[model samples]
Target chain A: MKAFKESILCAGHGGQGIVSMGKLLAYAGMQAGYQVTFFPSYGAEVRGGTAHSMVRIQYPEAIANPVITHPTVAIIMNKPSLDKFLGRIAPGGVLLYDAAAAEKIPEKTGVTIKKIPCTAIALKLKDKRVANMAALGSLSKIKGLFSLQELIQCLPFIFSGKQDLIEKNTEALRQGFNEV
Target chain B: MTPAKKILITGNEACGEGAVTAGCGFYAGYPITPQNELTAYMSKRMDECGRVFIQSESELAAINMVLGASLTGERAMTTSSSPGISLMQEGISYLAGCQLPAVIVNVMRGGPGLGNIAASQADYFQATKGGGHGDYNMVILAPAGVQEMFECTYEAFDIAERYRNPVMILSDGIIGQMMEPIEVRYPQKSVDPDKSPWALRGCKGRESRSIRSLFLKEGALEEWNRDLQRKFRTMEAKEVRYETYKTGGARLIFVAYGTSARICRAVVDKLRQEGVKAGLFRPVSLWPFPYKKLKGLDKGTTVFFDVEMSAGQMLYDVRLAVADDSRVLFHGRMGGGVPEEADIINIAKKAVKRK
Candidate 1:
């Protein structure tokens, strides 16, 4: 096998915290001292429209052009975003979308697709906003690229001492673990 | 230096932190999508750090403010995305002409216009090809994750000082929102603005030096360009950085950078499992592209797939390095759509079967 860098893409609506998920992954890479880059999209209409974020994580010496032309893994929170972006999935990429909100999966392709009820799982934890975090938890377990410990360490900064929010978000993530 | 511990912070926060760590005392910017967090974060922390955080009247004013601060030998920074960045180009070029060192961060999004707030790499040409005017290049650093945001932010400042030139941290929306653990280093080595030979201060002790890119003398302007070229050549040789993924024993190679490379890594793993050989080539530094490093690779006549978010700018460099025809292919998702791993695997398998 060849030595290669790992990249991740998180796409959804403006308020979906799609960019936050990418930030956590990039944070993990940066902590390891690997070269990491994060970029999120912005436009006037994104507030009510679909939005996405891309993160590139690689060795210090092995990165070029901080743009992701193709993604290996995608975590989609909304159906519109899924419909819009599903066609770009690489042959062996992992596609994880929210089944609870999506009416149906985008047919079938060569990619490894997983439809999880992220919002439902977050609902069980008493907050649907953490749905993005739930999806992140599932990604770590299935891909085995990131670990629970890393995600846990990241939670504090994300919630920023909001104990109640942290506790609930953590629960939502754990629920996602079981569901995935 | 050993690797630092990872922390979860948005790309905007990382940029602001990078400035703080880099001894930046002034920050000027306007509110723009995907990048509002940078200035917002600065507003919250700059005062505590005794830094000047200014929300200028416009993007133009913001960049000029940074220019003003940088002239006084203070480490200065500003950030914006696509449209806003476009507005600041004039100031950036002027700063370059004056040989001012300042760091600018661009959290790019889809565009020619308002485009979309979705993460996109459409600005590759703008950053590398000189967005403003004339023959000038900004030291562009593309960060695929949070740590790079922090590290590159600091490095941009360092490079700016070293070359007495404007440096750009060319990033996109995804990087701006990412949160990762980072080992922050407040590097030592401060510049004394008063000591600079050409800074505008009041000329209390010596002959006043006027900073301008324009010289009424015809030959003088040409000489300035020559000097810039010499400096750029030095940068190209000393600053190129890239990563090679599974180039050994592979008949197909996928070249991607930033976030796209992450997916490519997964694609490589899946292809290996399927008994197909595929690899990746990534360039970390944009300006001083790692051309020689790529040219030296032995692909055994493998096919090269240049993937990007734009139509293809980096592909031009790949072509230049390979210096061959019919061996290189292009794959990309324009606007704001990002390709998934399965798409990559399918492409790799097809390439393998074709060979």
Candidate 2:
């Protein structure tokens, strides 16, 4: 009756590629044979200001509703998002934020908070956009629920004609996998 | 093979699979809340499966793109939520006038303009009663879950082709965002008749067929409306699907559809556990409204509870089906707010207690 799925909230700035990362995780779950639903916000509300995506994943015969009210995982790509979404994560849930951008990691309240230098690492690796990938890599390492292979499977879909970008992004993903 | 056992899925994803399974070769849509998932899912899956997926610039372009793709005789689809679907009404009317067989899915949300991205069934009147400006009707399918999403989608394409009309998969935010196990069956062989008589596939292999909805002659528009009504009447016979729950010895029937119906089913189960005889009537095909099946329930029922996401759109039709003294009632949770089972069960208890 109630849609009780584990929801993931990916929030950040526009250029940070938060929407693509949310879609990648959703598609990864769908590829893994899990029931997955991904919803993204649009227009002036989401871009550059307070962008966020809601992803709900569930097992068979479990939940009913899909809109993510209490995200089990909160991936914050910026400080504003970290401040806005720190209270939205479920208690004891995982909070992964970019240590390079996030100023204060919200009191580390009951949830698991990981402050990784995603931007610093991606920039060092010569690809600034791969911070979201680093966040995804960090998520995989922390949760161990989804696989790196699943994330890799979604690369070609995102980078259709730009094979060069795919190769660089794959390397960025690998560096992220190793960092976190 | 009985088309294999159906799996539970969200309504939007089901519609996407429905399009893919029905041989929809082209999908063009702009990202909007409540419907982005269907397009996002199609983005990856459609390409992998050899279908075209284009993220259009605006909702207007998306519908017009679908109209363009439909002209080529390809199974094409486009999707949006409320505001975006509103932008598409002009194109929808054009498609209807041109007799293009395209499936448009609207995963509804709260609206008048730029409304909060939350689940609401306020678009009921828009979808069922003439979303666009025209004396025309689109075959509307309101899927309750993933199974209905897939099955109704295939059937929607069939109806669109059969009647030479556009079909709308009217769903809400909850149905669009929710997730359940959805097992897609192998698509049935295309046995439905073709729409080539009016389709614009460059007019090859036959006389040039003009696909336009413009008829300026006197009484011609009236004739077209009457002809559309005739097609609707025929659709009423072939379409019109609903599900009955615990109607064997019921005093009150809860009439709902889409995700609201799913919630009503849960409430009905709760009431059944408490020994209350509350039944459920969920319509799968919303256009043909299932007035006959609903009228059949009017004979034995004591009351009718019209539970909806909005203030009451479908209730009008429910009233049309039941008798005058049947104690028709309304309970709505509008503007993207989901109703709890406790509230529905309480309504049932109070309805029975009043009697």
Candidate 3:
């Protein structure tokens, strides 16, 4: 098979589940048959700091470092994450931001900008905590990195013990997908 | 692509899974950054595995606990990062001096006293060069990916038992923290201290075998050193492990190991597409050094580029192994920084320009 390489960076705060978003994407990406690597910041890199995760997916290949220098896609969950990563998106790449939470993002050219109000969508879904899921839905919609069916099927198992929230999260993802 | 039995897990979790797959029965460790997931994984799984897990009060206690268990002939292990590995140095030296079999993993973080939680391979001098004291060698296995972490950790117990010396899985925070999909296949062999003739488990109706490092008599320590050197020599002959890619016709050889090796691989692929004949030589075993692999190069055409995460720790070894000072070029970063593919490609271009 021909080589297909993609890297994504997700940045947000400590309790925002930004890391979980990377995990879910990686899991789904692997199921879609991509060699995936996810690197999460911890300790001094994130303790009382702006945390981020770099997820690299390669078709029929293994990637080194898992440290993405220029991400093909940047998923911003907050203002600081946007400020820190806005310039790092590759030319003609995509930047998805939670418009409900972030301030004005600096002007940029070439990169596609998708301003999804993930928090607003999640709020309408009755849980602002699922903003990450909204963003995840928008990401899959934009990138087509994984199938929606696979992502939906994996949710209950990913949140295996939490039977109560699976349906709500599935709804959040669907609403977020429709928002796109 | 038909996927293998893919299970995505952090590097540290893979290490824990490997330990269990290898049938390790004793785990004692203090939680530290990057490697904490390993301790937590073992903590949860050891009970189910019918093994022992002790979150020791300190790294010293943890390694000593490993030593205590190693004496009974159980496959024992301890996990730690740089600073904690430093704390376990005396125990490491003791493990070596007493010649007890055990596994130690240095999921290395930035160091020189609690530097940061970022990953670094600066401990190359420490892990492969003998951190504690005396003339000792740990069969150091460097795992570049999560799969290697699982397989190397699984194989470590067997190596430790076979050599009657400590085996180390020298990993860094990057690979330790990175999550990847892997296929894990565990071996069926289980380590039992009771099977070893040197085991200290109750000299029941038999002559006791004492294990200690103290030998104050004239030339006794010398004889012990001789014995250790003999084992080192044997390891040099039998334990060397490495992998090479596209080197048969390449003019530039990127010599590296661990995470740096993977980055070099990506660079090599890119350069190969760009019409630059670049190759990669990755050492899987650091202690054995794989010095012979650097030989038989087309001397007139090849230039070796030594890449590392630390500020050129492995460069010295590369130069020594290549035995040609003029051909080795060094580029690296430290304090938990990693070199990207672009950076290495630029370095390679600059190196080519100089000569």
Candidate 4:
């Protein structure tokens, strides 16, 4: 059996919900019986310049490195995120990004880039706030780490009390997954 | 035992759940960055549990409230950040002088002055060397991640109750603000205020006990000091907790606690893959210092690197543990800066070359 270990990064400004993306990944990883770790950049202004969250998931063996200075997957929600993190992705790694938030996609080798208009899809779903859900959906197809169904199953855990966001967020996730 | 559920939460929120599970009956705390979530969680939960939760006007008031609650033999606690904790040192000294059992949490941030709201472990001296003006040592549990934040908060109350002294759950902004999965395994064990013989509970049917720190009578204060010293020695022998990784046959060892330890673990694993033997010694109980296990590093070991987020605070303890036989090297960053793994890896590689 192969050991499962992959580090993912979600980067954007404060309001972009990159931290939520990191958390959703962790919740989904836990449900899949994988050990997980999540950390956000401290001391950064709550709504200030580029903010990022690092998450790592591994099987049984606890996430060894509590902090991921280098990630296997990079999810860029905005241009500032790309500028700061575009160089850190592992070789042959995966990049799931939002074309709506950033358009000047830098050309890089060895890695695969999937550009999904996450914000545009969320706005079309009538809730721009669910852009993070859309981004998570697109990340599902990048490496097929978690089944889209499993990712969908973790939604109720994330937006538990909201009740109302369950429907649109799922729709947004589906749209993002299919677009990739 | 496998936990029934896993919930993603920051260390601060996990500490809140831990305190609630530990039967924290009275919580009086002022809000501070990186630790505000703990106060907020207690504020809502304590009311539902029919306990007293006061958002005191200042940390000074909050700590004194904890002192009051503990005098009645109730399990009480207060959480604060670095600066806020500094303000509560005097009250903490009083708790020690009175021999009151209380729980104090310092979700430490950058220090010295009103430093930036980032992570640092510079307060090790203040925490272990008696932050207040007195000869006292609080049982300090340094949690590396969110899960320990929850479990140790519960255990901290138990230790304080057992030792009849203050227990501190020390964490940094990184640990406090970071989100991770945790399971709250223990439920709160409520303590009745009327149980302790030293408790001031209406003074009915028995001799009245006065909870006072001032002993002006001759030899009275000296006796209390001796008693405290013996208690401290007893705790040191019984309560040193630490974790070791790949230490059985290693060429290098890393002495770190909390977040820095986690980073060092990564570097150790990486170096091991490249055939350089490395290990990590993490002290969970910062007060007892875990010098015994650390002193066992055999002659096979080449060097020890003391890493921290502060300018050589815990490094001093690391040196004392190893006692200067091996070269105890130090590398750290401070004032809200985190120690990157690259710098640590570089430091270790340099030591390997010199060796």
Candidate 5:
């Protein structure tokens, strides 16, 4: 396959596992033989404030400039994130957002928008914290960049020793994937 | 040769792993933002490896502990951010003066005093120049990527031992917090304190020795200073390291280091696509400065554009190396602001289009 690059941005309020979602994506990309970089916003705002992470994956080549000014894919998990990063998506890029949290999303020219009901799906799984994973599931389904199995395999490493949480998160990911 | 297994890790963790792989037996550090991951990694990793890890009460104590460990001939290290590194300057001077082999990792944050936890190259002057009070120079290595973070730190120990001087791995918050895939590798031989002649290993079988920087005797201090200067001159001649990207027959070169260098590389790629002959000159060893190589790159027509996260700290060195102020231009962002690729591209375009 020809070398391809994807710059992804995951943004949400703190405690929503936005950084974890970005790590999962980058780890999956690395597993698929792609050079990847995951950069998280490190500041006092890490607690109950706006948080975001940037992940760039390039196949068969190293990634330069890990910071994404214009993202190829923006995963906005809440209203604040949608409001902040909506206009920064590249033309012809994909925006997968939480439909229940980010209400009345604005339309952007030349951008593909997929409104995934991420929070509602996580609520159905009996845990609303997995909303980031649900949104990530929709992202994978939309982009087809990494398979569901690849993402699932990363759970054991990311959420080590949390067997029950892993099971629920896996189900949440599957629900989000099937919903898309 | 066995192929190393690639693992996903943050820059901070990678530096810790590098130190561990280089047979670092002693690590002492205080918790600081951006660089806290390294201390945390060492806490667990050192325990697993049956080594020593200390969460010192302060940066002052931490650096002194490293000095103690180095005196005992253990491969030792300490890490911190900008302000914390400032606190350890006195200890650094002591290490340099005593001719000790030790590694210091500075994951620089924006700073004049207790600056916010944001990525900045503002500490370039502090790292390359003598941050502490002395006529001492520490070998400074600035790694631009996650893999180099590991590799540079791993090599820093050898460089320190080779020169019997303090060596610094000067990194920033961006590289510290960012995560990338890296293949970890170990050195062939671990550090053996008994092999060092100056090591204070009980001194039972050998004559008693002493290691101190305080020279109260007349002319003794001057003689020691001369020896230190000679070592520094030898380091300047032998230890300069840098990387050149696409500079072959290029009309413009971006001189940058660390995180800014990576962004400049992206700018070079974009400019090349636009038919502009742009390249990058990244100084891996900030102390040695690569003066001769930088001067050699000037063909009278090539304009050297220097970029940094600071307000042109390294620009002075570039100007001094090039010897002509007209041939050097600078673009920088201070107080934790990072220069974007678009801005650099615009600046480069204007520079290339100028008469």
Candidate 6:
């Protein structure tokens, strides 16, 4: 396999598990024997506030900078995040967003935009909060950076002792991956 | 020897773990933004190790608690952000004057006066220049990544005890909150307070010993000051730690520390890839700064570019080291603004062109 390097940004409302998704991605990257850094930014409010995280994964070479200005991939879950971060994506980058929030995504020349009804999919799985996980699953399919199984293995670690939540999230991941 | 295990952790928590692994017997800290996680981590981990952890009522209480603990020769520590650290300056001075072995972790944020809860290097002067009233110096270590946060804090205790003086781990909010993988290693032996001969355990078997900074007799205070100055000189001579990247034949060098240095490292790689011979000089120990090492890297033809998150607080030291104001250039962002790689690259390219 060629050396891998990727900078991913996950952004949405505070209650949407945006930070959790970023952590899961970073943990999976570490498990795959890659160097990873995860940086989170949010307001004082624990819910309903804007939140985002930057995750960088690199192999063989050390990652020098933790803050990602122009992400290669972006997972946007709400309208505010989509509007704020869509134009910041690198040229030829991939953007995975929630269809519910991105009604008028402008066309970009080299970027690929995939709109998945992440919240709707999570509702089908009986927990709309896993919308972030669904979006992460779509990212996995688009980039093929890590297998769905790899992400599932990280569930127990992140949500330890919460078996029901883990099962529901695993299902949500599978659904999103299949949809993509 | 036991092998180190890889784990993902934030810089704040890593420093806490470093303290615990180094046999920190007591911890006292008040909650503050960008550094509250460290206090929380200690509340749990310190208890697990059968050590003492206190959520002090205020920053004043915390530092005094640490001082009390250190007087008994216990490995003691306290952590805080910019405003909180400012509140602890008086106690830090006393720690230095009394010649106590203690560690202080400053997870710095935007400063001057309750600036903001964002990453910053504004405390550079306060940390290295003896922020308190009297004359004293603290060994300051700047760690740029999560791994270094752990390693630096782990070694800080030993460095403090070696000189019987206080040591400070100067970090920023960015490093404090960012999570990365690090190898966690435990020390072979924990610190034992009983081994310290000067500890005021009691006057059971021998005459009592006293520790104080109040030397008010005729010329008595002068003798104490001389002793402190000698210790500072010895530290400057023996404890200068730094790292240089691709400076062998570079025409331009970026001098930075902490988060700014991390960004400069990437800029160096990008500049080199574009056929520009750029290098980086990062001072890991900020107090006993690697001044000689930095000055030696100056070839008469090279341009030294200084980058920081403050309004050139460290620039003064850089100029002093190079000994030439005209040979150095500065690029900085203040009030929680961080220096970006692209802007640094642009500035460095222009400098190279002019050179």
Q: Give the local distance difference test score of model 5.
A: 0.91
Write down the lDDT that model 4 would get.
0.86
lDDT of 5 by residue, A1-180 (tens): 678889999998898899999999988887777889999994475768889999999876678798899999999887878888988899999999888766677789999999999999999988989998898788778899988888998987789759998998899899989998
- Give the distance in Å from residue A62's predicted Cα in candidate 5 to where it truly belongs: 1.8
Off by over 4 Å in 3: A1-3, A43-48, B298-301
Q: Which TM-score value belongs to model 3?
A: 0.96
TM-score of each: 0.75, 0.69, 0.96, 0.96, 0.98, 0.98
Model 6 global lDDT (CA atoms, 0 to 1) = 0.91
**Taking the tens digit of each residue's C-alpha lDDT, what string does model 1 give over A1-180?**
224566677888877778667767776666556777666664466576677877877764545445565678888998777877788766778988888758677565678888888988877776778999889888878887768677777676556778987787777777777777
**What local lDDT score does residue A98 receive in model 1, on the 0 to 100 scale?**
87
TM-score of chain B of 1: 0.94
Give the alpha carbon lDDT tens digit for every residue of B128-148 in model 3.
888889999989999999999
Clashing pairs in 6: none
What does the interface RMSD come to for each candidate? 6.3, 6.4, 1.8, 3.2, 3.7, 4.3
Tell me, by DockQ, which candidate is best.
3
Candidate 2 runs further than 4 Å off: A1-180, B1-11, B188-195, B203-205
RMSD of each: 6.1, 6.5, 1.7, 2.0, 1.7, 1.8
TM-score of 2: 0.69
Ranking 2 against 5 by TM-score, winner: 5
* Higher-scoring candidate on DockQ, 2 or 3: 3
lDDT of 1 by residue, B1-355 (tens): 3564555567789888888888888899999877888989998888898778999999999999999998887889999988999999999998888788999888888887988776678888888888898877767888766677888887888888888889888777666765555667566445566776657888876887777878878699889988988888888887787778888877778777776766677677678888887888878888887878877774548788888777888889888888884778777787777766667677767766887
Angstrom error of the Cα, residue B171, model 6: value is 0.3
What are the per-model numbers of colliding residue pairs? Answer: 61, 5, 1, 1, 0, 0
DockQ comparisons of all candidates to the true complex: 0.23, 0.12, 0.71, 0.56, 0.60, 0.58
**Candidate 6, residues A1-180: lDDT per residue as tens digits?**
468788999999899998899999998888888889999988766599999999999886889989899999999999999889988999989999998886768988789989998999999888889988888788889999999999999998678759999999998899899997
True contacts kept of each: 0.33, 0.12, 0.78, 0.68, 0.68, 0.65
How high is the DockQ of candidate 2? 0.12
